[model samples]
Target: MKLTLTPSTIHPPFGRYAHGVKATGSGILVASGQLGIGPDGTVPADAEAQARICMDSIVAILREGGLTLGDVVRLNAFVTHHDYFAPYMAVRDEYLADLRQKPASTLVVAAGLSRPEFLVEIEATAVF
Candidate 1:
């Protein structure tokens, strides 16, 4: 089972995410951070497109483990610049919209990623 936590004592999350998530299940799966590169080895120039690719990779990883987005308990995302924040969040929110209990999430603006062309990276932790 999973429980979303947003206690009245603290401010609500600014986005589509819970302040924390309490999960109890058989095991936890932590996916590595995924870059914006696609299977064709192409990286989109647009931040929103890159963000979508990152989220898609995360979804594929979760599905491989027999889990869905709803099973996700946490998310950590990194963007190359402050300008990319909104675009990244927009893509992320679209992916997580249907979940009953949103996962705890964090978004960071980094100086750069492994590759200069890469604009975003996303990782997830899921319980199953």
Candidate 2:
């Protein structure tokens, strides 16, 4: 897959992330932004829990897309606070541990998201 990263109109871009991303390919999967929908039948409503669940959801989508984590070519993480970085990153590493190929990534911090219960949101690009 081919991808393009764009700047966020609200927050100026720094070294960390692009404001947006665009992609085009022969055949591609635009995985929906996965929420931390857990077994309890409700979203955990915690930042770290949600982030981990989000990544898990991403993994599921990867499989559904006929790809694996190693196929991920780019990643974008959205969070409300930088303080959550360590724990969130730990969960990310746990899932991406054996990724044969690592994707380029960016983490975004915002004042708020679509929902207050959501602590983090993730969007990604994968080439398979």
Best by TM-score: 1
Clashes of each: 0, 1
Q: Which portions of model 2 miss their true places by more than 4 Å?
A: 1-27, 39-41
TM-score of each: 0.79, 0.72
Question: What are the clashing pairs of model 1?
Answer: none
| Residue ranges of candidate 1 with Cα displaced over 4 Å | 1-26
Tens-digit per-residue lDDT, 1-128, candidate 2: 43433312122332454323334455454444555556454667567788887787666666655667787777788788888677678788887888776778888888977667667777766764
lDDT of 1 by residue, 22-78 (tens): 454647766667778777677889999998877876676666556789988999999
